[model samples]
Target: MKKANTHLVLNCIIAEESITIEDVVKKTKLSRPTVVNIIKELTEKNIVFKSGFAEYTGGRLPTLLSLNANSYFAIGIDFEYPPIRMAISNLKGEVVLSQGITVDRSFSRNRIIEEMFEALERMIGESGIPMEQFIGIGIGLLGYLKANQGISLEILRIPEWKDVDFKKLVKERFGLPVYMQNDIHMMALAEKRLFLTDRADDFAYVGIRPGIRAGIGLAMHINGSFYGGVHGNAHLLGHMTIDINGEPCPCGSKGCLELMAGEPHVVARYKALLGDDPDAESIRGIRDIHARSLGGEAAASRILDEVGSYLGIGIANVVKLFGLTTVVIGGPDGELYYGLLRDHLKKNIFKNMSGELDIIVGRLEEEMYPLGSCFLVIDQYFKEPTLDL
Candidate 1:
């Protein structure tokens, strides 16, 4: 536990900037002598290196230390969708190397896994670094996670994904500790860390893409403690009713928010606008609209406006429920919707509400989903109860 604590302190230093033994003592609440002893061990290991002395104040200056960025690397990956992305990020979250592949969704499970692992091995080998330098893998995926079994219950409308034990299988094959979480949850964490105040604990994150999901939160200090409700499905945006008689959803809910605002709806709407076209042409159109949206096209702008409204309505309902101040939107369509999602949401929700709510775009994009998964692995390994670092 002491060694683990030492590793944790060094990691914290790396994530933040430089820190002194006093800061470690304060943050970790370890005695100064204990902190000194651990720092000495880390220094001998070459994981934590002395940078310089703190600026002189009144008394003797203290030495500052930080983890060598290249001393350790965390692999972040999101295996939720196609184009599997992997990022080799430093202890400070600076990505050093990244690689992605276009996935053939129809490929056999093992085959796809084999290809992804092969790609990972090649990238790691090309980095010319020892595997010892890696902190293991973190994965974020979009699925209903049965945490006890390490099984990801994912339903992406794609066949051949029934009862899959993703974590156990990946751990067995890769010989690494694996940690997985809901893709949107990880993205929400990254979003909070980047754009929102770190002190702000809870906010709902709604995703609209290959699937629709929500991670609603109420992590306010005044509320006494962060609340996620009993079921952790307080913000079931996909199940929220949008149109009473519009469409049927898989979750036995009719006209859910997701069915209305999600990618399927957008695809349906886009197809309606495009009339009849070849299959290839339709695919191109979807990709093209996203491309043009990225490039700031007026047509794309209008479409996002419509889609953003649906997003706003769903988020507005969340705000009305939890009253949390922030709502983050992410998915494949993140780039297109971020620009005006908040404005539209506020415009509609505030009309009936007394409290002020903030809507923000997700800093973690589609790529971050996999990256979050990788982060999960790295984090749990660091915090593993039995590990001694």
Candidate 2:
């Protein structure tokens, strides 16, 4: 009961930003005495502290309680991209320091782990923070995961990653608790907390990566919590069938959304239309295609329009199913052509449906991916301790 009460009081304080004991009681529905005792205990533990008196209008100025913000720290590592990104974050979820190490699929699994360890050691030494101050480490990787067990069910394109128990490995190495999650899901958590914490509680983040290794992912924040769906495979928006008769996907589906609307397809469609043009040979990636679209290349513009329309169709289906009003398009490829994509996306979304929906480009930097992983640890640190019944 005490543990649950503490959790409630702490969450109330966090939600209100800063609050007096009276407000905590009111918000948490706990008795004033219980609230006071919890606050006292929390302050002594440095989990929270007295900020300042509330106001002069009151006879006895109530002391405002706020999270200490540095009582503990967490480490976040992201392996979704080529570079293994790592960061240290305080209790308030602010990144204290961060670094990235290059480790692609070409490296052996052992080599990747060694590189990560070295980077982590260097970061810890530079931060001057004691190991005792850390709550745990969080890892974000691509593909599905047994998130509760911190096991990698499978990482697409990485042949040896099946059923890897990342949580157990990290815990044994560092003697700290560990959490694992899909990288895109972690990014969605960061998106909600960093950008939309105040404005919206429920929204969706759409991340698109285009290449020989093309993909699209979806992460939804439902009622202020990350929704990973059953089996954590809900993020496989790339495989969402858009056409039953279109080209077959590697996932054994035809007309999958990623095959039709992913940026690599945009570039391919542009080249197919520009047949035998020697200039087409110089067009290497999405960025080159985007430049052409900007320079009024009709072929490039048309391809982008087609891709954008396809993306809108997919996004609209998601919004309608989930009843979400806001959607954020993120990832490197999503951001690069967002300007051109947004117009076509909005048009198609409206064409298919008749409700208001806000589609915005993500404003966070690449580091948000790692920071989002850190949040997994930070969030767990504040939750009520539980026991098996």
Candidate 3:
């Protein structure tokens, strides 16, 4: 059974990143005996271990009960759209194994799930990692879901998805705990980890994909915690209505952000102008073409620029209202995303608001969503490490 004291110490570990037993006692304000007991139990459970010795305080060197990075591993399952993906990460957030299985419009999900499980087992077998070391599997569905209830609500448009209690079904079938969340929120987890606390706290991440969703993250230095926003739907930026009357969205909104900044809309809007070049149905493909053409193609460049302009309009509003110092754009196409958006956002914020703006893409661009799923699980267990943007 998990004790309250152990939970406190663990929270401290998650909060401070690393600390000594004495530091844990000082921070937690728990009696030395209680701290010691909890530490002992944690070490015995192989959850925590003496990583190293603390600084010389001119006395006996104290031992540190840092989290065991090898203590457990987590599975992050993110759909890369054209290619559904999965990854295995350790407690330290290292990718141990990865695989992707594509599911097209003609594909049957029942067969896809079977293929996914087979691929997962193959990866596990190849990695030589013990099944017991796996803490759980974190899944990122590219749509709305009552994750706790294991119900998906479209965007990815899985056939027969309505009847699937994903979390319950996956857990029961695999005999391992499975946690699911909306992809955008999960990607925000990766964004939070990639940016240090100083730059990341209280920032929001918005991504444009086949759909539009944003994850609002609050770095609570007050208590060393964060809120992913009520059911992790806080940053529904696209639904915020920049234009009261523009385009009709499936969510019953007219002129939503998704229609303006999302991948499908971005490509279709430009494809309408370009006519005969490529059929970009996925964010990944559009991004590839956008990156290639950012150098020469005037038409493609304008599309990227326009998407950035729309993003700037939406993001600038978030900065002015949220007082957010930083806003991250994580999508397949940066050629169109942050560049134009940053240019216009700076202009708007300075003209209307008073705060420094720092907009840059985080580290996990290609694997953003998958890492986001892994990020959710690892973050709950670790401090959700981040890289400087």
Candidate 4:
């Protein structure tokens, strides 16, 4: 009962940013004495502190209490595919440390895991915060995850990661409670909590990554809550069929949107447009292709134009299916190519249906994935437990 009251008071303070005991009492419906006791306890622990005095009235002013953002911390790791990233965040959702490691295909999964551990050690050591200060670790990974069982069910070409128990592995190494979720879900959660603060806004977020194998995902925030499907794998928009006789996908579908707009396809298209075997290093990834497009390379621009059209078709389908007016494009590729892709994507969407759709790039970009991962832990730490008789 005491812990619940403290959490309730703290949540009230966190929501208002700064409030007096009278305000907290009214908001939480707790008695004056109960609110005072919880505030005293929280203040002594340095979790809540007096920010300043409230507005001056005719008499004495009330003290304003605010949550100390640095009281506790969480470690978030983005383990989606390669270039695994991590971030340490405070209760305020601010990143204190961030780092990543890109693994070569030649490197075994064991090697990659070792790199992750080493990175964690270095990050913790560098943060100058005590190990006990960290609440837990949050991890976001690609494909479907059995969140309750702490297992990943994604069928991967990487044999070592097939159905791996990542939660157990991380907990064993760090001895901290671990939380896992689909990467796109994490991103959507973070987007809602950190950036999209408006409770009435319903939107769909699309993350696009261009690499050896491209990744595309969708996360929806409807009615102010994440809409994870019954199995938590609802929006696999990349696998949506765009062509009837296009290239086959590993997901056992041909003419998939990913095949037409993914990095491999983009590179293939660019090379074909060049009409010659270009140096392999000249166009390493979508980043490189974006650079070429910026450098006035007609082939790269043409490829982006086509890719945008295909992506627009896919996004249009999502908008119509969900009846969403706002769509956010995110991920590294989205950040780099949004300007180029926006008009094309908009035009294609208008072609499918006439409506005013707000298409924009995600504000968090590359940082959202890791930060969102951290939020998995942060949200749980402050979560108000359910009351059951």
Which window of ten consecutive residues has the lowest lDDT sum in model 3? 213-222
Tens-place lDDT digits, model 3, residues 1-389:
23456667887876676789888999989999888888888889898878888788787887766777778888888854446788888776778777777665566767767777787788778889888888788887765567666666555356455546678767876677777776666766766666544664566666655432222122221123344445544456767676787888767889877677666666667767767655444334456547657669787787777767777777777777767776666656544466667777887786545346667675556554566677677755544334444
Q: Which window of ten consecutive residues has the lowest lDDT sum in model 1?
A: 212-221
lDDT of each: 0.63, 0.80, 0.67, 0.81
Clashes of 3: 6
The TM-score obtained by model 4 is 0.89
- TM-scores of all candidate predictions against the true structure: 0.78, 0.90, 0.81, 0.89
Single out the weakest 10-residue window by summed lDDT for candidate 4. 347-356
Q: What are the clashing pairs of model 4?
A: none
What is the alpha-carbon lDDT of model 3 when measured against the actual structure? 0.67
lDDT of 4 by residue, 209-298 (tens): 656777788888887777767556778888999998888888888988888888887787787777765564487677777787789988
Enumerate clash totals for all models, in the order shown: 9, 0, 6, 0
Give the TM-score (vs. native) of candidate 2. Answer: 0.90
